[model samples]
Target chain A: MNEALTLLSFGEHGWGDTIAIGALVTVSLALASLPFGLALGFLLALAKKSAEPSLKLAANIYTTIFRGLPELLTLFLVYFGVQIGFQKALKLIGIETYFEVNSFVAGMFALSFVFSSYASEAFLSAFRGIPQGQFEGGQALGLSRKQTMTFIILPQLVRLALPALGNLWLILLKETALVSTIGLADLMREAGIAARVTKEAFLFFGVACLIYLILAIISSTGLARLERWSKRGDTAR
Target chain B: MTVVSSDTALPPPPPLPRRWTKARILGHVLMALWIVSGASLLFYLVTNINSPFVQKYWPDYVDGFLVTLQIVSVSLLIGALLSLPIAAARASRWKVLSAPAYAYVYFFRGTPLLAQTFLVYYGAGGFRTELEAIGLWTFFREAWYCVIFTFSLNTSAYQAEILRGAILNVPKGQWEGAAALGLSQPVTFFKVILPQALMVALRPYGNEIILMIKGSAIASIVTVFDLMGETRRAYSRTYDFQAYIWAAVIYLMMVETLRRVWDRLEMRLTRHLKR
Candidate 1:
């Protein structure tokens, strides 16, 4: 027990620092991708709902391809295939520098792409749930398209989208663990290293699992509160 | 705007011609370009199907597919069986029976399956002495057993939650109806509640199975020669990007086919509920 404690101690000889940094990396990776994903998802939803058949088709194909693929395969394709393609393109353009995608960037890009595909579906359904009369009402009040979107549609869309988005966030958090496979020094990777160095796989992995559970529990509670807060206006109605 | 005005205007102006805006024209052009590029890429891959590298590595992918199927099937079967008792425990009114069940589900669901896999696979090595004493060391030492164990445990938690939810979804009137019919508790539950709960749980169970199929790809990272593992190996050998593409296509086909079959099954099972 003392040996295990020492192994986990926050000292130069211990892995506490590495594991902490790994956890931070995992959180940051998820955070960095969230906005990109949500924005793209919003765009995709709009494209899907647009009157233009071409735009709708494009959005359908995009979501289908991304959603159909596994997350790890997507990561690998982006990391390896894109890197190779990009380097070749650069070479053709007479750029000699070797450009490679770091694991974090690859993970962020792949995960965001996957997240957007799923989130687009959520956003589309939420958009569909809005009454047509609400849009007509906005128009009757002389609201510009932008104003109607921002002031009228978005607020309600958000309330509808929040629960699904929260669930997506949870999935995203867990997915950060997959980044470890691509050699990212995230919490899972750090635990792996600690396990290898100390031959204490049980201890380190157990610690990692506990950390993930803590994050999940905290986030779940926060999400529950957010859901309640979002519905407060509804309760009054 | 024009349509509204036309209702008040003379003769409705021939229903106004369909006008394509600049954005619409641009969208059409871009969509055409996208389809052309996608088709060309597919054509390139098809033409290269007979390439020597692909010919050599194709069998590896097939083997990997078989291994993946085997692992997923066995683990799912074991997981479904294991989930029933856990679900029963979770649904129990007694705290003593439910608390540990709740903890199991919570811990398993909260953490990533990768962590659980590592804890089982690598962690078992750390307890070789204790395992050997209990004659379980040989099982832990093998990656196959470890993967099966971890996958089963991880999936059982999700399955138990689905089952418990289904059990609760069986209406209270069901219990009353059973009691009024002079049925014992066990007979009522097995005959009435279980069937209804199972019906309600079918869609979620299908979703869980789909998730497990995707989740099983992680087993490749642990050196199991699953489809993803073969894809990785093929990529390393030939530096061909199509290897990953092939694996992705296979996975896509599996998921899509499973979803369709599940939907059909759900429709058939719940047909009685529909008017």
Candidate 2:
């Protein structure tokens, strides 16, 4: 027990600093991708809700492909595939320097795609929850299509989507661990290194699990509060 | 008189035309990003299908597919079996039984499966001495076995909750009806209640299986050569984006097939419930 404490202690000889940095990286990765994911997903919902068969088909195909594929598989594809694509394009342009995709950038890109695909479904459901009369109401009030979307539908859509989006955010947080496979110094990777160096595999991994559990707990509480706040103006239950 | 005259004059405007103008114009306006990316991706896929990619990596992918199928199926079977008792425990009135069951579910549901897998795979080394003493080291030592063990435990938590929910969804009248008819509790549960409960569980079970199929890709990180594993290997050798793309295609096909099959099964099972 004493030895375990020493190993995890925040000192030059301990791994506490490394693990703390990793936890920060994991949170930042999830944070950076959230806006991109939410925006893309809203667009997807719009596309699905549209009248054009071709546009709807495109949106359907995008969600099907991303949602079906494994998160790790998507990560590797984006990480390696982007680098390869860049290298080829650079070759074509005669800028012979080898190109690379940063692990953080690649991780964010892949997570955003996966998050958006899932979020699209949630957003679509939120759209369905709105009545047809609401759109007609917007029109009767002389609002343009865009104005109807922005001023009328958008606020309620955000409220309806909050729960599903919160769930997706948790999934995204867990998925950030996959970036560790590609050498992003996330919580999982740091734990892995600490385990290897100290030969205390159980201790570090257990610590990592605890950290994740705590984050999940906090997010659940935060989401509950946010949901309550969103419902403040809503009609009596 | 005008309303009736117009209603008679206009052969009910086709449902399509009314929605086409407004929504289509919005769709076109919102699809600027789609126009560029969608066209490029379609072009890339069309141009690359015949590029000697499948020919080279098809065998490896096939092997990986079989492995993937084996692990997922085996773990799911084991998980379903294990969930029965846990579900019972969770549904029990006793705190002794229910508390631990709830903890199991909470831990597995809250934490990432990747962390759980690593905990079992590498963390097994921490217990090397104790395991060897108990003649269980061999089981924990192999990545394949560790993965199966972790996945089974992880999925069992999810399955248990589903089972508990399904069983609870059966009305109180089910129990009372069985008692009034002089049927045994176990008999009533097995014969009268479970069938109805299964109907409730069917869709969630399908979703769970789909999740397992996707989650199984992490087995590759532990040196298990599942489909994603083979894709990584192929990509390492060729550095071709096509390798990962092919893997994605195969996975999507699997998911789509299962989705169709499950829908059919759900329809068949619930035919009596519908008109």
Candidate 3:
């Protein structure tokens, strides 16, 4: 029908523009959270490998608790939980302006926190696979511990971690859809509004699905290439 | 990056020159900061536990908790049951049997579950008048059915993958032995292959179930009065956003209990494999 076409058309009445922007937001947020997640994961891995018993226990608890909990619940805790914590802190400073946490920032932090827990384990496993002899060689050359970790251990770890890190990125990309519940103007949220407004729920939702599928396919292809590149040496035999 | 030789069975690195001196200090400092933050949050949560609003709304909170468990458990059971056949289908050598199941898994796994839920709930909602004309409107009319359907399908995709991986991990020699015994294909699958695959699949399936339990929170968006639904209601009405913290605690406890159950199941399944 004409109505369905109009509903889906890229014209002013259509949601084609809104949905495109929403998809971009989702991708950006996922990318923005990646480095943050990687840094946190690296620290957690380090903590777990630390000699201090307390530090190791804390790291274990962090990963266990976050990985075990649901992503939605974790989002609630981070979004609302962080707001409550910040407000309480503000109360101490005697400054209250009804300032609210930005949904995008809160959403990114929540996701990165969850992503880090999984990433740390992957990174740790990969780091462990690196020959300790490399570190020993670096140490014998009068290299500082930090230099050894950076120059010797990390390069090998990156090679091993690439495939896993790519997979985590894929998961993170999909997980970003959950943020729509908190009123972020991501693809899902935008589609939800358009569906409600036009009452052509199928039209808007189908578009959303297509957008997500496109994003997923593109990212997956890139990830597959990275995975293949990482495994190039193994294929020679 | 260089690929080291397999013969290089390297010894552990010597103690870092300064040992754990700076690193340990920095580690302690960083660890202490995180622990303090976590402890403070716990303290805040506990102190607010006795608020009058908590006492008044305790029943609603409990209702939400129960609803969460109900949705999660049902969807997981339904999903698991559905996935077993789909997984078997995926493992089938026949292209006719495998292709459709493979596509199903790919589509579901390729997209976010949240999008799938919306497409089903809202997209299906658009066909309401037509659906009502048929006998199936009764099922589609209820939010519960929509939530359960969406979740079951999503989890089925994941479960199928897990099952496929587990099936692949089964040794080829076992299948040969089953053939040597002159067992029929179905008998081999049910008796020999399934038993082994089930052992490997159980732990991952347990994790999936727990994930579903937590995922049920999303069902609230579609008017399902699950735990997250109830928590949202409590927060909006009383302006006590801290109610989410309580919900989080309940979810944490559920996950912890599931972890213990998963550990036990893993131990039980692998007992024979243990040296």
Model 3 lDDT tens row, B116-235: 888887788788888988877778778889889989999989998998999899999999999999999899988999889989888888878877886787888888888888888888
C-alpha lDDT of residue B53 in model 3: 80
Candidate 1 CAPRI classification by DockQ: medium
True contacts kept of each: 0.71, 0.71, 0.64
Q: Assess each model's interface with DockQ, reporting 2 decimals per model.
A: 0.64, 0.58, 0.50
TM-score for each of the candidates: 0.93, 0.91, 0.91
Standalone chain B TM-score for every prediction: 0.89, 0.88, 0.87
Clashing pairs in 1: none
Model 1 ranges off by over 4 Å: A94-97, B1-18, B21-30
Model 2 misplaced stretches (Cα beyond 4 Å)? A234-237, B1-56
Candidate 3 scores an fnat of 0.64
List the pairs of residues colliding in candidate 3.
Answer: none
**Which candidate, 1 or 3, would have the higher TM-score against the true structure?**
1
Name the lDDT of candidate 2.
Answer: 0.91
lDDT of 2 at A113: 99
Candidate 3 CAPRI level: medium
